[model samples]
Target: MSDSPSLRERVRTEPRPHAVALLVALGVGIGLATVHWVGLVAAGALASLAAPTVRRGVAYALGAGVVALAVFAASLGPAAAAVPGMRPVAYVAVGAGLGLPLLGSLARAAVP
Candidate 1:
């Protein structure tokens, strides 16, 4: 048999969940700042695409969401102070940020 690694083998040895999650979180934060909800969902889905399985994608999404939430909370004060009615927006953003990852995971699962 040939020694070349298959796609499955390559994917299996790719970055771990924590690393993927952290990267996803960073991208999600940037996306949230620039493009709002659409960016957040896209970032989460793209980031988790590297996962070897749906279960791992879900876990990575959760970790990414948590990190995104922390970033959102830390930045909330400045945003809220600058804009009126920012609290409600922040709440929605945070919730969406958390939930979008599940959608991303699902999307990942739906693919091959």
Candidate 2:
């Protein structure tokens, strides 16, 4: 065996279902942001690409939730910071509204 892992070897070691769930969640985020229903459609399609079970769904949802929060926070915070005398409510709201709810839902669902 090679001391260094090959690409195929690395791939074989990955958790396949976890990867698929992330793709689904990311698709959902992109779809909603772009108003491209096709993205959501694709997300749903890829979701099934994972092992069809509650665990996979929840994992994918959690990954997507985290990505969405990060994206939203990055986008909103800079804009809010640029404004003079802005109370930062927009940034806070984006973090709270989008990030918290999705994460909470996924966390709750993840509990067996």
Identify the candidate with maximal lDDT: 1
Q: Which candidate is the best by TM-score?
A: 1
Tens-digit lDDT track of model 2 for 20-110: 4556556665556445433333343334334335465544544544455566557667574654455586566444434443443333334
TM-score of each: 0.63, 0.39
Write one digit per residue (lDDT tens) for candidate 1, span 1-112: 9998665446545556546555755576456645566655665665566566778777766666776677666776766565446678767776887888667667568765
TM-score: model 2 vs. ground truth: 0.39
Per-candidate RMSD, Å: 4.1, 9.0
